[model samples]
Target: MMMMMQQLQESPVQKNSLFNAMDRFIGAVNNMDQTVMVPSLLRDVPLDEDTEMSSLKSGSDDEESDMYSYYQLLKSIRVDIEWGVRRAAADERLQQQESHKTLSRRGSSASTSSYASSSMSLSEEEDSEDEDLQKQFQYHLTGLQGVLSKLTVQADSLTKRYKKEVGIGA
Candidate 1:
């Protein structure tokens, strides 16, 4: 009974074995065993160790030297995750823009078709009603765009802060 309740409250990440793996990877990176950590890095982060080692080493390969490649690898993964988040936000924005364009086109075609057929059967009162409905839809679409724009701004700001914390520039 206690185990069932604990399972229910566990986070998705906590429930998955991947989270355990990530914790272990972080431990290995902090431990400074580049050989052990490098394999894990290649499997997960896929960085070029030669370049990363050069950056961290500043030019010596002394076994007990202060320099370690794992910190750079950890930092690189954090940067990559931050950039991935920004890319996902940008992709969402692009999708919203396309949807807005498609809706605008749809509304315009509907108005044009309605106007063209106005002479046949739709009464003046019905025309006014349709116009009101169209206005309401346009207003809703404008509100949606405003919300998305605000969200995008917030996402950008969050990403900037994350980069700054990770010692990376926007």
Candidate 2:
């Protein structure tokens, strides 16, 4: 009986995990925004060792060590997630690509035996590529859940670190 109620509560979260993840991350950023009243105080203060280790692991834009940058990044991520900015742009690009493919296909016909055989092979390759893409998307979706949680914690940690630096509370 208890399990059924728990499952019912979790059903909506499972249905659209991305929105919930974004909501969690955005809420954390909003909390950080209120806590860190004076952002300048975070200017030169470096993030924690965990962030340093993450920078080393990711080895790209994550190389930034300053707390101020992390603060800005958290806000930026909040905006991006809240708006689905990247996803919308990517969807537009994909639509354009699909339209182009449709136009090109309409201009051609596989009347020849050789062309028909090659088209069949190309379709098989496309199927395999689609499967690969699906796998990658699923993997990224799983990663997105963990990453959202981590970013929420990072936001909280930053707020706490800022408070400590400002001698507000320990």
Candidate 3:
């Protein structure tokens, strides 16, 4: 047992495998497709109902689990926001570089009017794309904010409930 535990501790892959198994179990539970099989598998085993009741009564573990999930969602949203910002910045830089190159070429060429018109059109197209990107970012930001607010409310309520259950004044 000690050797197994030590090996598991030393192997990140083992930890990932364990988490993958847990994820699949949770997914199966959520889907309810394995409900019959689960009951049959556990038919000979006795479950600790008192422990479940005590855990539910305390509610701290549930709250922490919920908070962790919300934190992960928040992290994912932040990552998306960062990616969008970086992409927008890169697009802007690319457009500026393209415009500069066009300007330099126009100065040495005889097609000034044509180059100017093309540059204007390119700028307009880029601006439109930028606006679209901004709108998308705004939509995601608003949705994320709404979700974050809801999560905050839930966490606050959970904290209050846990406090009351433990006979602590909030």
Candidate 4:
């Protein structure tokens, strides 16, 4: 059991800062008294509206000041995570496309026996390889898509729940 736990501990996914920050954010949001705090939080500064840094950093209004500070921290961390995920996804897609192109080219141009024998076997191999690569890509893509979608849904649900709890809804 200890060895299993240690192995899980050592997994790269467990060490991801994005995951850690999100976990902490969710925990903080969950623990907050949404009815009391969130309405004021949402009204003072909405998620749709961008808070100016200068006003936030130097504002004298107590409510605006506190809300702006929290907003800044939350927004900054979220933006960072969003940028990282987008960049990582783009890089992965580019690599996959390049590998696919290379595979196609190699299969097409590789020297073998006669045209019929060579082409038939090569096509079969290419088809199988392509299918395998596609399956692998789909697996990773599905996992990533699921994680991102779940995060978005959770954030949105939390926001709506907070609004409802605080009687912020019209």
**Pairs with steric clashes in candidate 4:** none
Local distance difference test scores for all models: 0.48, 0.78, 0.47, 0.55
Q: State the lDDT at 40 in candidate 2.
A: 86
Write model 3 residue lDDT over 37-78, tens digit each, in one string.
222332222212323223322434443333233333333444
Give candidate 4's whole-model lDDT.
0.55
lDDT of 2 at 89: 82
Question: lDDT tens digits, residues 1-170, model 1?
Answer: 99998887886646334434444444433343323333332222212223323333443344422322334435454444334545777799999999999999898787777666555455876888799989998887666455434333323333333344445555
User: Could you tell me the TM-score of candidate 3?
Assistant: 0.31
Which candidate number has the best lDDT?
Answer: 2
lDDT of 1: 0.48
Mark the regions of model 2 whose C-alpha exceeds 4 Å error after superposition: 1-16, 48-64, 86-115, 119-130
Q: After superposition, how far is residue 79 of candidate 2 from its true place, in Å?
A: 0.9
For candidate 2, write residues 27-126 as lDDT tens digits.
8899999999989888766564445224423442545667888898889888877675687788999999999988777665434445655646877878
Model 4 residue runs over 4 Å out of place are 1-81, 85-130
Ten-residue region with minimum lDDT total, candidate 2 = 51-60
Model 4: lDDT of residue 82: 53
TM-scores for all candidates: the values are 0.28, 0.64, 0.31, 0.30
TM-score-based ranking: 2, 3, 4, 1
Tens-digit per-residue lDDT, 68-146, candidate 4: 3453444444565555546777799999999999997787667644467653577787899899999999887667555
TM-score of structure candidate 1: 0.28
Instruction: Score residue 165 of candidate 2 by CA lDDT.
Output: 83
The local lDDT score (0 to 100) that residue 32 gets in candidate 2 is: 95
